[model samples]
Target: MSNGKPVYKLIDGKGRVLIPKELRSAAGMDYGDIVRLGVTNGRVSIRKIDIIEVGDQSPDAVKAYVRAAFKTMPDDTRLSLIAELTELLKQKKEV
Candidate 1:
């Protein structure tokens, strides 16, 4: 009865509806990747989680990536990994 997105019907004795293969391909989701779902102010958005490779798990590489992320973050958001690290270092020095 809804004219929005196409709805799949539950079939057989069990209630199960499959995700359309076309939609899955469009979303870039695969068998093993994780997905995060959230709704804010009544708007919903889905984003695929980033998969970190083995080579990128090193401390130096991770720190570099985090620093790069901070550089591109918007000025309005004061929350930053760099600021948190700085505060942690200052606290360590005081101890």
Candidate 2:
């Protein structure tokens, strides 16, 4: 819905709904990934619990990757991951 596209999914009798791979992968989610759900205006929103890179081989790759990856991570995890990645990237550059 963020891109003005609508996604249709099926909710089963047991109150479970499966999110397709494309959408999940876009949000950096895979099997057993933790997600948080919230309701607003009678609509439910699901957010990924962590960041996962899905970028390609290109220039400014780390910058691009981190920005996109940060969008999906939970607030609590974002800063720590950024700090870790910053240190890692610095180390990579030093090598």
* Candidate whose TM-score is highest: 2
lDDT of 2 by residue, 1-95 (tens): 45759888788999899887778878888665546577999999988754433544555445545566666689889989879989999999999
Query: What tens-digit string does per-residue lDDT give for candidate 1 at 19-54?
Result: 566666777866544444569999655566554345
Give one clash count per candidate, in the order shown: 0, 0
Global local distance difference test of model 1: 0.60
Query: Among all windows of ten consecutive residues in candidate 2, which has the lowest summed lDDT?
Result: 49-58
TM-score (all chains, Cα) for each model? 0.34, 0.45
Candidate 1, residue 87: CA error in Å?
A: 43
The list of candidate 1 runs beyond 4 A from truth reads 1-18, 51-95
Local accuracy by lDDT, each model: 0.60, 0.72
lDDT of 2 at 93: 98
